[model samples]
Target: MPEKLTNIRNFSIIAHIDHGKSTLADRFLLHTKTIEERTFHDQVLDAMDLERERGITIKSHPVRMHYDADDGRTYVFNLIDTPGHVDFSYEVSRSLAACEGAILLIDAAQGVQAQTLANANLALHQKLTIIPVINKIDLPAADVDMCLEQVEELLAIPRDEVLKVSAKSGMGVKELLEAVVARVPPPETDPAQPLQALVFDSVYDVYRGVVSFVRVVNGSVKVGESIRFFNTDLTTEVKEVGYFSPGMKPSASLLQGEVGYIITTIKTPGDIHVGDTITGYLRACKQPLAGFQHVRPMVFSGIYPIDTADYEALKANIAKLRLNDSAFVAQPESSIALGAGFRCGFLGLLHMEIVQERLRREYNMELLLTYPSVIYHVFMRDGSMKEVDNPLHMPDPSHISHVEEPMIKSQIIAPATYLGAIMNLVMDKRGICLKTDNVDHIHVMITARLPLHEIVLDFYDKLKTVTRGYGSMDYEPDGYETSPTVKLEILVNSEPVDAFASIVHADRAVYRARMICERLREAIPPQMFKVAIQGAVGGRIIAREDVRQLRKNVLAKCYGGDITRKRKLLDKQKEGKKRMKEVGNVNIPPEAFVAVLRASDDKG
Candidate 1:
């Protein structure tokens, strides 16, 4: 039987990256005896190998736990563990929307970082009760008092009300569980109302089809019932209804205010979307629940199989991956240099990296990724607008009036010692400083508006370098601004290599061109004839480099022969080079294209 609505507590844990969010979830699982001590491992909720290796959660994982509260009653707790990185903020928002409260985890030694402020604001915006907790207190360098003060000052939460727990050592976990039961209110729902379940997340299993993870808000759903998706308007019979006991366990029905998974046996992944409302077919909901806002991709890149034979396999894998990751978008695109591929859009740089890594590791495929870019709105001379997500799709500069690049509101939190370096770096990236706040005597937060393209390329790595790894950053889309931009095209031996072309600010085009040309010079091997690598904007060349021919001296065999013989050999060699330059096509290695993406490594 389903537990009483009053006994169900649905909540999530939100925190900055590497702030012990997963570790805390592990403690909760152990405290409630959800898993045997012998079977328990580190970061049990982070099932993905990538998440474990990176020490961060990429996807939000939901698990149901049963706790015996101090009030002499058993309570059902649904814990949604959310990703901490800014790229996964949309996932965090959806998880928060499905919860009644959120546990704000902060690292005691690190204090409040940029993502902490961003996620806290998200929880407050959703009207969920915020419970601040300072984790990792067992460390020798842990500064609990300082973190507490930062939380109070930044989040406006009371100091005394904040809880303390060391998730690693299991200290104060029992009390923390009790506080959850007492402080976090149970879900509010009306069983008499029509069925309306919020689909927060979903996954596609080869055996079971689409399994939607939902939080039932009103009414109830049972097996063999006909359900309709509010947005898609597609109806299907429920194959199964179940709750997550860390893993899926079949249940007869899911009543109001409960969290569980639903198996609809729907094959097409697009039919069931995250944030869609599910209702009974017979008595459908008149108004669907307030679904989440559609997430837009902030970074774009081209992914192609190293061998064209795997093109179909790559496409199929991407379709399957999209069944679980809705934020990823891919469209078929063809490149003269890279062959058939897909132009993919991502939330951020890390998100792009994660997807690429998954394609390689999970799907066991060899792939080539083009340089990442941001979408640009090209205003044409004919008063028409074209959105360019890939540099290859960039319109000719002569036919375009101007280009508008996406901008973002960036926030950086770091030690006060690196404030000058951080400011300098931001200004160099064409960022406008909005404001800066001193969290305490030791920590500071900087807010700025920067072009999305700048951040997509090596900004995070540079930030960590300047701040000595003590800094953290978060950003959100801040619309777009018109800018003077041009397409920088790379030509090898007078032939345009579309893979190396990029859209850059006009002011920085010359510098970027020079950098890419120099990189290509090192990446391209010497050929029989000199290859001129030029970076051009429309009809004008801005930067150039030449890979000198590999000289095989035919004249070396002359030895002490007369000057006439040597002259003949030299003339023949020169003619051969001239002919080669006219007809020889440069064969650029795949690594050359990859090197172009990292051309700014030293400079950045």
Candidate 2:
């Protein structure tokens, strides 16, 4: 029994974006013959259409491969390929927890990036063995020596241990797999103990219900056995047990130290939570496994359907999507301007964009999104605290004591020549430079602290622009600090639009207000009466723009009329315009809201 566990090597591949993690995963499957030659393609693990089109791994993919080692021994390898973007760091962490070691890949051309360091630290914190590898040696700009030196100097790893491989060309991958078997220790678990499995990922199937991807730490789980989730305390009979041979392959049982999925007949998507432990229903473990920390959403926005009748359908679609993405959250909410919709929260801007795109493409739902905002802690004068993510829920000025905003400690890597520009860009976002380190002759790393609200928009895009697409950024949440913030409300013809309300810092409120007003002026068409687009902070107008009213020219037929007649007609027209202004309803087009959001992204 112990010998079986000794032959199992579980590890994951982690790296920065575009560093060839998925390509490397494909190579492994091909080399091991886990996939047929006729069925082989690029990025075989990325099954989603959106992921293939974007060329990024949005979800972590796991597969089991059996490799015949040079020592004439057969070994089973459990490989997990993870996403490299900052927003998907949670996915990477969960994947790391299921493995015994991690392959840290660095692009030969782009030596060490911000996310590269961040992911390395996460693995170090978890105490997983790290294998440094240099990828993309086939590129013309590959600097293998510089990357190896940087790995030693910056990552504090020995240069001799680092491996060089071209994932695209499948060079040296065999040796890399051999190294994994030699270096990465096998899982230490006892088959005689009670069932204790960690749920790292899960998905909902129409026919099978909830299929949980788990790593069994102790004992074995099989069909017809009753299991209970440690977190939710929900019990259900295991319908089937299986392993991923790049696809589902049902097995008799998942033994100790093996990675596989379990089909629970539970149809509710929210019943099975990620990071929950699965144990025997009759014989439970004394203590639950140390699961992952709860994910806190960093950004919030309203997702309304263009057609109101799709509310129930949209809700069901979101529930299905959330089954795969545990980080994306949603709650039913109504807006005075946008009507019934769902208020969704995401990890970052990119995550939000992907979810919106998924809904549009996967479910065929047309959506209207409002401006994104971060959660703010509002301390009321009555000795109470409230967490506000929606601007419409902000308490009155007299009842509020102070506001605390979320901050982040960001790590940015860029070329040395663009250091000045990067510094200025950080400063513009109301951030303070903490320190700067020279990574090499050409690359520099800068650490800074910035308000979460400032970078929730286009900060990353700006950083890339200044660094000429050579910059990368990673951030961690810092505790909130007391900041003077005001609720900026957009009033169209004196009627407040709840969807257009936002919380802004007092000092920059005027500039942000001006941007919104200008965009609205351009987007809104001329009305029958004069329309006023005003940005107000606590009832005080800070920015204003007017849309000129359309005139029918009441005097067009008065070619040669008396002066009194002309005056009478003009006075009558003025009285009619005044009445129209009082009762007229401004039909704001959906495009106007889109324009305002686009403008806010530039100035947020």
Candidate 3:
């Protein structure tokens, strides 16, 4: 069966973060009559509440739609949505590889951003048919023509190729769809080959397990057929097969030139690989497809449980959570003090957020997540162990001779007027300025190489503030370099507060310690019993604190009918105490913990 390529259009929506990709996806879904008009209000593809609240597309979504043209010819549209953040760049590449074309959504006001250039270049690299669309024309600050001009200049594409449509107003949307049908080529559909599909994205449903969202490349799929994930030897019978028109819609089976989902009954993320192809007959692939290995896990983190009590639950939840996302690699990890935690590997930061959020939201598990750190190679005396996720577990110089801290090629775009401020900010964050380009006298594009650790300094908010919301960042892991940095442990009453341990460039430990104390004073609550906080290099405390009485209450009045009020007051205090962390007889508030965690940030 040769695919109905003339009637098929396979493409994806690509854009910068919050440029309205998901919103436009919903509008397209509505136009295609795939979803009800009034159902989805926010990001439709951002099915997870965390994604919607965070305002980021954490995963790529594959959907199928049918559009009835004015010419009365019905066309099947397969739209895949990709994550915009630099963290999910690998995932985005995979998505782009799967699609023949991509819709570049640009905010009418915020022209071509770093991501805009990055994703567009990715599309161009893959030879993906690119159609530029100007979104948010309804925005008061929208400079639609200017944005269109920028896209043309950036890529040297024709102005007519760009579609100026406001996804919000439903204006110019039909024309955008028409552009898609005309410009983007359809998928190659030939059923002579076995049923093969590329998994762009997947999610774990407790009832369904690993429901792999796939874009079929060749052949056909049917229920009760033996199938296999090419990367993993695991094979299972296709228990159920369905198609997605944004929402999961039941289908008898999907053929070539179709996008659908299949439930393998194999319930684990390890069993599913993103670029892994699916075949009708098990072990049918002669060789696995191309562009599979480019998606390397870039960022690493030591994910721990707050309470040792949650250890078992944490392990169980992570295992269950991995059933869908193949990008997550959780290895059994532990610390003498932190008991048990997973050295979780992720494609990027949003991948981390999705994993952590899924654990809490779906599995109902509590997570004590440490700062995300990359794997650093240390050449040790005996041998070498690749340090993954925990800076506290960093091999000392006695254990390791040399080290490599992962670096990122970071690019930020902002108003040209703020170039000096951004330059100072990036330089302060240990960034090596590569170059800066002025965008039409108003916007500035700055490129730099920065250690991934340098970015954990709460620069996201500060970047917005410094650039007056005119700046945006896009970065990808570049390479690793030898670093002379060391960790400084902050101890509270001789017990290492796991969350309080901070990492630094190691030159200014005393300055960091004093700053940690001041920040802790702001973060830690006034306590009933005086507690001492010490920032130490080894067992010696360079900085220390002695907290005084917080229970100095003057109970001057004891009214006759105020016994109930006093009991309620006591109960309220008890509730407050319950909320406050004991922290070795020291009641610490949550804000205090975060404040200490972020105390070393570049505030000036």
Candidate 4:
């Protein structure tokens, strides 16, 4: 192990979405000359195609760089880039746990957003040194003075001390890098102690198995040493150890206070979980690191293959993906309408969308996803309680007591002009306004307590619409609350479809049911006979819509016939229609299952 741990700095960039975090990271790489100018690209840390397309970072990327400061010394800097979306806040937390400091980036024009405060709080809770940096000063709308005042006001840092950088033009980047080394303290190392590495993140490699990203806090790890995960109790010999020079490169060993990757050739990604502690088998640490909590999936939905024959393949692919992503959970489930499939749980809607996109793009499989739902606690009449994530598993209302739904503490930052619209939108989703604060005369921050189920739907889109894309929001689990709720089921031609069932608050059930019925009426094709689309709560029908049958040519063939003959023909056609209504099946379009998600108006 190196004796001079003071030469190393471990830090991450914490910022709001579209605040030029990835761009700053790119500037850092360029300043250090880590990658050649010919090979340089925008958002290099964002490796996924989806990330590049969406202009966001979906995964946490760690890279090591060497920078020569004007102080006559070279330093090793480990920069961990994190995702800025609320859906990946846990990822930010894990990244912060591995760093000793964080570079708090705020847009010069946009100022500090809701996520900026949320991430700052997270970094402060970790006892990390924060160096405030204002980015994108090159823009015409840039308000550096205003941003500096806001930073000093919110972060309590002196206005003149905060660094300013234009990540795109490379202005002030050198000073920013030097500020990281001068302002942020190096990791405290104790190489003589037993091995105690914190596994902050992990990813799967088809050829090498599970690659664990760790910060060696106490001792060191080598390729031939036997290591055990404190959480899983699984022991294995390290196949390889390396550092990310933006890409994996083999290293002899990782020392104390150094961040690197360890390959254990562990086939099951679930076994080598994130937030686990890694220690040498011969000299294990006395206690594991703190803040190690298993990720609980908040939102869930059913995912079935478009073709039934791909069911087994989809299951296999999910298992493989789960090996890499421990936050994603799936269990075997069967639906009458969707057939054999799995009920998958995710951190949020964005996470769910990413997983579905990966399944389609990486695995080349088409899928049908049911409406997203949150976990519900059901109390039964027999003094028993069960937690249900899938609406299919919901118990009968007759045997159940009241239900409780998950709630979240949400924060929104937007222009004051949209305050009324935003509040109305939130309240429509059952959100209770808690408080409001003025960041400046033009911007305001609103805090609210809302049902998690509501936010998992189109709440975000509605928020964006109401605020004219100037608003950003972040949320955390605020616990659960008891609400009058019931599972609303959709039936087509008197047959219930489990895929269209949802547990909704009693006050909104009628509106939601009507919306679903109306949407189904539009999505379902006209049948030979009238088809009844009904939404029911238990056995009581709450909303109904009928699809009128297509007009037949039964009377068209009767040319100049007697009136009695025409009546007989019409009577025969009516009798056939009655028989068809009894025996005919309604073939619902796939869009009908997701119609509730498209319900935009409150009237329903």
Against the reference, the lDDT scores of all candidates come to 0.89, 0.90, 0.76, 0.88
Please write out the lDDT profile of model 2 over residues 1-604, one tens digit for every residue. Answer: 5788989999999898888888899999999999998999889999999888887888877899999999988999999788778887776787888889999999999999999999999898778999999999989999988887788778999899999999998998999999999999999886567999988888878888888999998989999999999988899999999999999999999998999999987887778877788999999998878845677899999999877898889999998899777789999999888889999999998899999999999999989888889999999998999999999899999899999999999999898899999899998888999999988777888999999999988899899999999999999988899999999999999999988899999988998888888889889999998999999999999999998899888998899968999899989998998999999999988888778765636556
Encode model 3's per-residue lDDT on 1-604: one tens digit a residue: 2336678888999999888888898889888888886776768878778789877787788888998877678888888889888777777887887789999989998898889889998899999998888888889999977786677667788887778888877889999898888888878665556777887777888787778878778777888889877777677888888877666887888777777788877866556767778875653756666777535676676777767788888888887666656667888877654568888888766677678778888888766665565666666777755664566666554676766778888889888888888888888777788998765546778899988877754676778889998888888778888876666787765667765565566566677777877777667766765567788875668888765546533233545456787777667666654454354455566566556543545531
| TM-score leader | 2
Ranking by TM-score: 2, 1, 4, 3
| Clashing residue pairs found in predicted model 4 | none
Residue pairs with colliding backbones in model 2 are none
Looking at model 2, report the run of 10 residues with the lowest lDDT sum: 595-604
Deviating ranges (above 4 Å) for candidate 4:
1-3, 551-568, 594-604
- Model 4 Cα lDDT, one tens digit per residue, 281-329: 9999888988788888999988988788999999999998787788999
CA shift of 579, model 3, Å: 33
Provide the TM-score for each candidate, comma-separated. 0.96, 0.97, 0.84, 0.95
Q: Rank the candidates by lDDT, best first.
A: 2, 1, 4, 3
Q: Give me candidate 4's TM-score against the actual structure.
A: 0.95
lDDT value, candidate 2, whole model: 0.90
